[model samples]
Target: MCGRADDHFGPLGWQVLNGLFGYQGWELESMRDEVRPTDPIRFVRRTGAGFEAPFGRWGLVPPRMTLDEARKFATFNARIESLHEKPMFRAAFQAQRCVIPIAGFWEWPTSAGVKTKVRITRKDSKPLLVAGLWNCSQTPDGPLESCTIVTRPPTPDLIDVHDRMPALLLSRDIDAWLDAPPIRAREVALASWQPRILQVTPA
Candidate 1:
């Protein structure tokens, strides 16, 4: 499971978004090097008019789950295999799918009690638009919006780094992955998702 991400794309992040989603506006800046759960991260959402980049919390906090309750349990990464079965993600999986634009992500490759941190990025060094699910919850203060990255079993090349990786979508598949009916969206993404080899070990 991925718990941290790096979105230091700076001005280039908008360019990537424009290229992928044809979004013409900008309301976000470069995020911190490590964006953790509950942090406001930039993501793309489809509106009735079109798509736009907006800031959303990195954890999935459904309308029924209080922020306090969600914080106690891990709701950052939704496993693809159990998306429909997971109580925390089922509704969002069906109606609130989104795309998280990221530079790359970090994972703790563990063996026994020992752990090593590694930064994973595509060999091409291009930004990755990761698949995710989002939801909005009403709170006393206001409405709280959050999202979760979708994960699938890792390909053989990435199994050593982690057993699961963020479900990835390519440029051509982004439309269908977002516009298709919820179940079809999942199927489309799973069918077209490509596993990339990452080699950005950062100090």
Candidate 2:
């Protein structure tokens, strides 16, 4: 499962986002080098007019869940195969799909009875656009917005590192992944199982 991510995007990252969708008024003042579950992270979600980037908790909390229940829920990642069956993710999968842009992600692989930290990023060195689902739950403090990354079985090259990896979308497929109907979106999720190229090394 994809439990941690890196979000140290600088000027070049903003340039890529601008090239793809023009300027959407995104503020990354709180960006971090290491993002853990339950921490605030930014994700791009489709708005009625276009797309908007907003900070939300990394763990997803279903709209029907109470804050107390949400605290007990572990929803940092959702498995692609069961997106339509899980109560916590079903609604978001149908209409609240999102894209999580990260510089890379970290994984711990066991070797010689020891776990070593490894970082994975695109070989081309561009930001990764990972598929995700988001939802908003009302709370006394205000609306609680959260999101979860979608994971699939690892590709051949990454199977030794982890059994599951984030579903990463190509830049050209962003629109189809976000605007397509539920069925088409599901197809997009499946198609995004493997990225063009990935570089994995010790962190």
Candidate 3:
């Protein structure tokens, strides 16, 4: 599960996401250096009109869940294997797929103690376009949007660090992953979690 990330990209980072995702509508003013579940983070989603940059809570909060209840289950990362079957993620997986812009992510190895932190990033130093699902909820204040990252079994390179890793979309496949039907999106997602060229170090 990706519980933490480095997101201090600022406006320039948003530009990078827009360029990679081919959307000119991401309108976030700033980003945080460290992001956690429930924290507001910028995500890119394709609307009927086109792409929209919306700041959403990192953890998915289904319309049925109250903000407090949403905290009980770990909704930050949804397993790709059960995304379609899980009630909490099914709808979002089918229609609200989005991309999470991340500079890097942190994980703790099973063999390591509680204090261990391993930072992983692309060898090319590009931002990771993580596959995610999102939903909208009606809160007392207003409508709240939240999202969850999709994860698959780890690639050979990352298995020692964690049993699962975020489902990643290649720059070329971003369109299909975000706009294709559910079946096609799954295919694109499976193929996109390829042999990775990663740089991992202790954080």
For this target, which candidate reaches the highest TM-score against the unseen true structure? 2
lDDT of 3: 0.82
* Candidate 3 per-residue C-alpha lDDT over 26-105 given as tens digits, one digit per residue, 9 for 90 to 100: 44445556788888877888877567768899999976889899989899999888888998898898889998878788
Kindly give the stretch of ten consecutive residues in candidate 1 with the minimal lDDT sum.
23-32
* Cα lDDT, all candidates: 0.80, 0.86, 0.82
Provide the RMSD of all predictions against the true structure, rounded to 1 decimal. Answer: 2.3, 1.7, 2.5
Across residues 59-161, which tens digit of lDDT does each residue of candidate 2 receive? Answer: 9999788867877978999998899899999999989999998889999999899999999987867788999999988899999899999998887899889
**What TM value does model 1 have?**
0.89
Which parts of model 3 are misplaced by more than 4 Å? 10-15, 22-31, 110-115
Ranking by lDDT: 2, 3, 1
Model 3 TM-score (2 dp): 0.88
Stretches off by above 4 angstroms in model 1 are 10-13, 23-28, 111-114
TM-score of each predicted structure versus truth: 0.89, 0.93, 0.88
**lDDT against true structure, model 1:** 0.80
- Model 3, residue 66: distance off in Å is 2.2
